[model samples]
Target: MSPAAGFARTLRAEWTKFRTVRGWVLGTVVAALLVPLLAAVSAAGSHASCDRNGVETACPEPPLGPDGHAVRDKFFFVHRTLDGDGSITVRLTSMSGIITYPPPDHDEIVPGLVPWAKAGVIVKASMEPGSSYAAVMVTGEHGVRMQHDYTGDVAGRPGGAPRWLRLTRAGETLTGYESADGRQWAEVAVVRLPDLPAEVEIGMFAASPGDLTVKQADLGGLIEQMRFTETTAVFDQVKVEGAAPGAWRHTDVSPTPGTNPGEVHHPGSAVESGGTFTVVGNGDIAPVGTDGGMAVELTLTGVLFALVVVVVVAVLFVTAEYRRGLVRVTLAASPRRGRVLAAKALVIGGVVFAAGLAASAVAMPVGKHLLRGNGNHVLPVPALTEVRVIAGVAALLAVSAVLALALGTLFRRSAAAVVTALALILLPHVLATASVLPVELSLWLLRVTPAAAFAVQQSIPEYPQVLDFYVPQGGYYPLPPWAGLGVLCCYAAFALALAVVRLKRRDA
Candidate 1:
């Protein structure tokens, strides 16, 4: 038979084999129906809870304390040293303060700030006050602990002065470290700052209440930088001699009731040891695809599983004929070997392509509806470039199917082909990312890798260093979205072409 005729017959035969099996249809249907329903339902419910009756309730306004002082501001500010360009410095003497508006809930200090106990401030001191102690006034400790003398040193000037005030958080404790030359660190004191059910002002304060002279230093004023160093220090770098008072000062500088306490330079935001949080009062961010910022990240892990299914089916398509050495007989019937491989590729590609598109179409709307009711979804974050992103996702699936077809032809054994294809699609990206490639090379590699193709689906550009143009200003990559997807497409085509070359020259 002519190569064309042989190709036509082989294609028909493979199609027949696929239809005879039911797994593909079943898996596709499951993916299409379930994804949408679950996502929409969860999203809608969240929105309803935030509403009070017919009206959406506003977040409770910040409250005040008794000392005529408005305990603390809702907003917490942390200032570190900056270089000549106004950029923040990573040197020593950096300081960070946590300002809890009203005191947070605590077990210590009665009339404390709780849901009902809403008043006073809770502080844990690292350094002993010139002459004072820290205690729970209205609120007490609720097991919110901090580490003392965490790791890195605070940056300081040449005169052995603090470069910046440093605050570090590890596990339970938050420790403050002071540095003279951004190298050697001195132990300030360590205390469990108040943070719990109720909100409160929890930060550094310098109070000096005496008759000789009155001076309440600004904790922020002394700061040069605020760096969080070691989480769990190994202490491999420590060398101790005898009593070196100049090396470090360990005084119980806890907050004591003062006659004239100094002003808290800058109280920082309350530190919650757990839970995901964005900048408070920052605009609501919705997801991609959806109008609200909730792009339902539906990772169809089933794709990997489906690759297995395809491999199994392909092997069955070819190896089923292998039984009793049927492959030899089949090859004899079609003298042209390349024709046989081409036909198989065509049949597998068509089926997977159609199935993938159908699945995507069905899954999206289903997931949309399931997610619609979840009120927790913020408004969608839309950029003019997002439309290109949508196109890229569709392109990605097409490439996946093409690659799968090549794998089926390359490894006639179903299990082997599936594993090989999965590894090809998954491992390159993993290995590439794991190693340290330079920025330009890394971006280019990501653009060409199969894994990078999938990243186009990320509505929000996730990596500022590689994938985006500007992270702080929310800028996407300099390349247009379509252009980026094109880079991915080039990769897919290259792999497919290479597979075609191998099939033409190699024996089946």
Candidate 2:
């Protein structure tokens, strides 16, 4: 017979044998069903107590984005209109605040402001959530910093020596400077805001991000709450040059409503106090938490666990034949042992692929629905990303199944093959993602191990601009989706090749 014809017959025989083994066939089906069912159960109880009755019940006007993440927009703005081009210079003498803990017994006084408590000079396009703006300020303990666009941060002098800050706007470009004496100025940062309007708000502003605490839920969910605090900063020597403007407007642009119901405290006008004003305000404008604060991806939560079933079934597909002495009869009929091995790998991989694809297709939408029904806000992604996740999952299962089969053929023992597959393919993923090891070692483990295939199912990305935990424990994959999966595919191909070589040389 032709090589192609002989391969076809081997594939048919392998398929018939797989179907006749009720245990293996049933295990595959159970894996497919268990993924979606477990996802549904996990999602059904994933609601936070604050979100149990929807976010509106507890926080009617919560600063939430389209993806239901708490946004950073509210801050106390004590700004004056700068028409055309101008510069705002201020001397920040001191910044202080008092923080409180959770309510009922929330009487603990920290006597210090949060780390990111800001008091500085800012030139903003507007008081919007994602508006273009820049500020040079003194933090509570982090010293001086120049921050802009809700993400970019430039460090200034540490230990809080320099108190003089100056922000100059030249058309679309904004330059920040820091100095101890005002005459000897050191450049802090220079940023250009695209299409910055001719008239903008330029003045001293103060804000505090407050204390944030995270509570772990019983069912693998995180509840995050931020306690708003009153931050006060005293700004003096407030000078506005190169601009023809009216009096400074004391706007209460505090992002956190009801935190400070009073207006911004301006001790005296600059004109009356010899170009010096004391401005007291509170609120913050920083990157929102993109870490565990976001809702979980319920659809893919059970994928790694389902892989256990896939590994066992795949190992059994080849090892069971050897265990029962059925491989001798099969090898007698098809003397081409390599072709028989290839046929078995193809049959098992294709079956697992179809099963995984169907399960993921049903899981994604249903899981999302259950999450929303449980009053959780699911993070939205592009349609192409959703497709990649589903397709990647199916490919991961299929390739891993083939790898297990190759191990089974080489070892010829079901227990040994299954344990080896788990050790090589799943253990590394668990360790890396659980943060059991250091981040560098965890990332290295994923880079070289077959468990890197788990990256294929990662939907979230780590953004440098966002200030959140970007570890694998927080759903951030070390490698790109396709690159990680490719590593697993290479390992599987190498193992299968070795298995074929052994089968060709050894007796059945």
Best by lDDT: 2
Best by TM-score: 2
Candidate 1: tens digits of C-alpha lDDT, residues 1-508: 6756767887786577567667654544443333334444444454433334456643221112211111112211111121111111123221211222212322222211111111111122212211111221110112111121111112212231123234443323434444545467654435442321111113322111111111223541111111111000001112211111232221222222111112232111222223211111100001111221444334233343444444455445554554445656666766666566556656755665555555445444455454454433332334433443334444555455556655655565666766665565555444444334333554555555555554554454442111112311122233445565566556546665666676567654
Residue 384 of candidate 1: its Cα lDDT?
A: 37
Writing each residue's lDDT as its tens digit, candidate 2 over 40-137 gives: 88878777434322344332223443233344665656777777788988888777776778755476756678777778899888655546688888
RMSD of 2: 5.9
